[model samples]
Target: MSEKSKNEPFGDLMKSMNQFFHEKPVKNILQSMDDFFKNPFPNSASFHVELKEKDENYVITAELPGINREQIQLDVINNYVKITVKQLNIFTTEDENQQITKKQQSFQQSTRTVPLPHHINEKKVKATYENGLLTIKVPKEKGKRISLDGNE
Candidate 1:
């Protein structure tokens, strides 16, 4: 084949891509993605969490802004910690005659679970939430040391 044949395929590919990008559907999809990323909270299920080990305890700090303590739930099961947040929004519009014009209700819930390398004492776990920050302290379970020496 001639060199022109090889270059023609690449040129055609580029042209097709250029046209695809200009299409309305592709443009809308791209715009939607851009708008989604532009918002800090794209979905209700997203939050930031930090987990660290400090002084024989696992400390977990989660950032849950605009949420109240009543809407948050914490659980520790099988060495896994689960944090759940549920939010409910209600909006109502009333007309001049004291009649309800429009009523809207929305509920959003998100859960985040984290696993720890060591076992934690579920009964001794402590959690506190203040100012949109949730702090959980899980105490590590004590393990008995086994000696390797052979004995009767």
Candidate 2:
């Protein structure tokens, strides 16, 4: 008889053998832990906007990083402006040094809608993108009454 066989009890050995063969729950728990650690942020995307009024135009700037231009959509109707950004997740697997390597990649996606303080000329709206920043210029509506007209 082997030394290990002699040292271990028969009942304990049988239980261990059963556990090794029936490992579905253990495998599920391990997989859940792996997914939890790999995805710390479930949402995976965020954004911020800055609005400024300069002379005859309202300048709106949005910060979007790690996203492609094709995944972004913009719409302006009346005084409401809507912006949408989408990003896809990419996963890669490889085997190195007898170990599995997994790499997860994701991009930014967000949407924002805001009402302009004053009406704008929709036909004259212009948008520009540079270094992951999107700048939109909307010409202010002409002859609009100022709210502080009677205050001063």
Best by TM-score: 1
lDDT of 1 by residue, 1-152 (tens): 77986768687788889999989999999998888888857665778899998887889999998899999998888889999999899999999998999999998889999899876678899999988899999987778999888776
Where does model 2 exceed 4 Å of error? 1-44, 92-108, 144-152
Estimate the TM-score of every prediction: 0.71, 0.54
- Model 2: residue 14 alpha-carbon error in angstroms: 62
Model 2, 75-122: lDDT tens per residue?
997787888998778887878764648879986557888689766567
How much is the lDDT of residue 113 in candidate 1?
A: 95
Which window of ten consecutive residues has the lowest lDDT sum in model 2? 143-152
**Candidate 2 clashes between residue pairs 3 or more apart in a chain or in different chains:** none
Stretches of candidate 1 exceeding 4 Å from the true structure: 1-41
